[model samples]
Target: MAVDDFKAYIRKIIHVDMDAFYASVEQLDDPNLRYLPIAVGGSSKRGVVAAASYEARKYGVKSAMSGRLAAKLCPDLVFVKPRFERYQEISKRIRDIFFEYTALVEPLSLDEAYLDVTVNRKKAPSATLLAKEIRQKIREKTGLNASAGISINKFLAKIASDINKPNGQKTIAPDEVLGFLETLDVRKFYGVGKVTKDKMYQLGIFTGADLKSKSLDELQQHFGKSGAFYYQVVRGIHLSEVKTERQRKSVGAERTFNDNISSEIYMISRLEAIAEELEKRLKKHGLAGKTITLKIKYSDFSVQTRSKTLGLFIASKELILEESKALLYQERLKNSVRLLGISLHKLNSEQNSSELSAKEAAAASRKHEQLRLPF
Candidate 1:
């Protein structure tokens, strides 16, 4: 298809996210784990749960909760260590299914992805039907349940996906959006986190309806930048696009050590892995960054970060690691480090028009400077 025709066809978007991915994977691998309360992660004193099954969630178990607390909540809750390799394998399988319909796929994480299926191979007219079939395929192939959301844009599609639980699909047609959003909870709105929610509650904004009742000035007074987002979301005017190829502003990777360590060598080993991951992502995206940041989390949960800006943008993985390792040792850390992360910030975009213009101006200026011939 021609580029303009493809652009015209790219309108319908569907977001698909598996319900309790890690826990579901565990259940798929072992039938005994099915229908039983299970939390995937560690059950040790200091460990944390990565995913909690719906059955386990009934007892208040949740992801990121301390393993100690999860066990206390559900005494029989099974904790399984995460197998990222296996998860990635399944993720690839899931993505392959998306390719059967459209090539415009944006994966949010291993378990969730957005697909632009306005023009699909199957010639499916309704996005809802496509969502349902894709979900069914995922379940039949992997013995896992996936929830799908169909909408006119990425924002609505993301919201719709979570409306229904496992093995379900929800569609929000463009015309029904206003009423649909009015009754939605404030927490469900994208970008409204714990802090924003609390502030909105103070202003008597509990639901989308309440938020819509307020004027733009009223919202902006409480939430300077985020108030605009609230105003737009309440009006069902989400401008966020379904970007298949987006220039990442940052690339980062972080990992928690097996045991807390004060030794610099152990910390470096962890940093190496993080740097490697960041490098791989940078190479995959065909991008680079001018800033390198190093983050450290102590045993007591206290966190610290250091960053340095380079003169030139660099895409070399070796250079990223070299600069990151230097930043790690540049300062003397007093406490034992439990987690380490390496990130590349201030990423240079490969397709931004403004960046291209700036490059052109700089080249022209350099040419003028050379003509001056300063001795």
Candidate 2:
């Protein structure tokens, strides 16, 4: 196909990500916390840092780090308890700003989302300008800064959003997508974590250009299903739409012990408590699933998952606990375990034909559509 024909099929996508959301909110609510290194979560030995302020980040503090480690990284770091309700309230306000420009919004989490503005409520011709307007509105309304990335697809847009951190935006024109992706580092790819990056490095796939050199068969042989994904994304062929109503794939809850436990009897008790929490979450969402998965995280940080699919969906704590116990004994512990979790998959929502039909219809209406770019 000619370049013009290819550009005609390109869709405008903008990924908006809030900066250090949880910790930023803490600072927003307290004037004294501004410019100081602070983390939002418990500071106890067993507690984890939910979020860290930019000031803390300079000291190598980050979310999901243990509080003890975070404090060690930044000795003066202040730890504050999470206020989820307040964060949700602020998130809603930011989302409202997004809706003003386009209804094709897919929220990835409370802190970020993908917006499709190929056809927008404001009839805007420039996604770059739309992103600017959206970010400005968020700051004015919530007193928080957001970053954005604009491109022809979700993958590139998401990656671009992180280029200028905290409060900024970057635009990758349709004509620039291929060159931009080709030189990009493999480690910068959205789903490439540390383990995957290491594997890619070992395989000599250090950049998009290197990855693009591998044949499809070679990638599949090495990386299995994810190989196909890596192949397509490197060539800028991502086709995932910005879903307006993103479905929940799974619901789960987990607990990390203060100390590793080697006792099976004690582990079962902990699993039961986790099941209770998972049950409440499942019920809160009016969801049930046919598959139950038990996630075991060892003291060494190695993880294992065991799953069983039943004939029917279940959401009760009793059934969940029953299945978890069976799976817990399914395999002997490799070493002392530090965390146990219960998750439900193949949710009832995935089986909802009406929702699927609606999604299909919406996708059909936007098929092969192109946005009018201002550049």
Candidate 3:
């Protein structure tokens, strides 16, 4: 296909992300919490913030930061325990709104999703206006603020959503996609985390244009398989689709101790408790796996993972605990342990589900050649 013809096949993808979802829900339920620096998670010494309100963000408080550190950042920060059930209820209400327009909705989490509106039930001529309408409907139904980004594909759409955040939206037109990506900072690229950003800076790839200048071989030499991904995205050529049914790749549970424990005996007890929790989660989903992984986090914040694959799938508490104990003993502790987790992988559901691989999905997407949106 010619370049212009291929561009005509661009999909109308919109990434909708709720603004500080967990924290916002708390503030919405309690009038007093509004406009305050509030975090949704435990307030204990070992507690971690799951989400932070915009007010909290101003003080450098963010999700995953320890409760003690968050408190130090914002002395007046209110810590609210997470009510996951309530959040799930609101997420469903928002998802219902999404279905009213299109059935091609891919939820990233409780607070964010991607909607492919290239062929929507609403038959809306413009995805930009459709996104605005959807956000308005969400606010009316759930009393929550959502931001959206409309673009040709999922990657750009996801990135654009963050441009005007906390109840705003942005649309990147086909004509503007290349220029938009060219000047964008490498750090702002979706998959480029702090470590990758530093590496890219070291390689003098500070902008999308700089990334575009590198050959595929050079990118692969530096970034491994991800190099090909960066090379494609910088030119606005991502082809990932909005999958409606996402599979669970793993199930696990973990906890951080109030004080780091160094004793192997104590760690074994903690592992037993964690294994029981993992078993409950597995049974709740009627799932079992063949691979058992033990995750260890040291006091220095470094993490290590040990995994063992069995010939048979296991989900029972006894089996999980047994496997976890074996993996835990497989290696010696390097430092004082701050956290431990147990996860089940190579799940039975994965074997049963006929989900397409990334390559297959990309190839399938190419079969559809007429996705011309009015935009």
Best candidate, TM-score-wise?
Answer: 3
Model 1, CA-based lDDT: 0.78
TM match of model 3 to true structure? 0.91
What does candidate 1's lDDT look like per residue over 191-250, in tens digits? 789998898888888998999998889888888887888887677666565445555668
Pick the winner on lDDT between candidates 1 and 2. Answer: 2
Q: What is the per-residue lDDT of model 3 for residues 1-375, given as tens digits with 9 covering 90 to 100? A: 267754754788899999999999999999999999999995988899999999999999999898999999999999999999899999988988887887677888999999888767787779999999999999999899999999989999999999999899999988888899999999999989999999999999999999999999999999999999998888778878787677899999998999999998998889889988898888888999999999999999999999999999999989998888888788788999999999999999832213324454444344455655556
- Sliding window of 10 residues with minimal summed lDDT for model 2: 351-360
Question: Each candidate's TM vs. the true structure?
Answer: 0.78, 0.88, 0.91
For candidate 2, what is the TM-score?
0.88
lDDT for 178 in candidate 3 is: 86
| Number of the candidate with higher lDDT, 1 or 3 | 3
Query: How should the candidates be ordered by TM-score, best one leading?
Result: 3, 2, 1
Global CA lDDT of candidate 2, please?
0.88
Itemize residue pairs with steric clashes in candidate 2: none
lDDT of each: 0.78, 0.88, 0.88
lDDT of 3 at 69: 96
* Candidate 2 lDDT score at position 254: 98
